[model samples]
Target: MESDLLIPLIWTVVFGILLTLGVRKFTKKQPTNKRWVRPKSTDEINKSQDE
Candidate 1:
């Protein structure tokens, strides 16, 4: 093939592979053993104390 065309073709394929792999990895489900908890904020704590 030609010289200039080869470089851009290689870059496109490499980046395309990376993008697909990243999307697949992100979409894969992960196992969870426990539920998530949210902590109370400082405002809530102050209001509770003042009441």
Candidate 2:
């Protein structure tokens, strides 16, 4: 009984930590400028594809 509860509690903590780290890793901005890349609108994408 205790073992069952303990196993899940441990797993929850571990998964929570991993999830937090993953979110932080992706959310961490590296810095960028228009020279590297820029966002394109849907219309631009459609126009480019048509050409």
Candidate 3:
């Protein structure tokens, strides 16, 4: 009875740690200026110029 509960409790802790690390690794920000890559079309540029 105690072994059954202990097994799941240990697995839960291991899974929680893995989940935390996986999210930290996968959701990390890349070093880049994202705004500079998006070029405006001529029409869009002209519209902004008119404002």
Ranking under lDDT, best-scoring first?
A: 1, 2, 3
Error of 1 at 2 (Å): 0.5
lDDT of each: 0.96, 0.93, 0.93
Ranking by TM-score: 1, 2, 3
RMSD of each: 5.6, 8.4, 6.2
What TM-score fits each model? 0.55, 0.54, 0.51
Best by TM-score: 1
The digit string of per-residue lDDT tens for model 1 on 1-51 reads 998999999999999999999999999989779977898999999999999
* Error of model 1, residue 42, in angstroms: 64
Better of 1 and 3 by lDDT: 1
Error of 1 at 19 (Å): 0.2
Mind giving the per-residue lDDT tens digits that candidate 3 earns over 1-51? 699899999999999999999999999999786575677899999999999
Candidate 3 CA-lDDT value: 0.93
RMSD of candidate 2 to the truth, in angstroms, is 8.4
Better of 1 and 2 by lDDT: 1
Residue-by-residue lDDT tens digits, candidate 2, 1-51: 699899999999999999999999999998766485678989999999999
Clashes of 1: 0
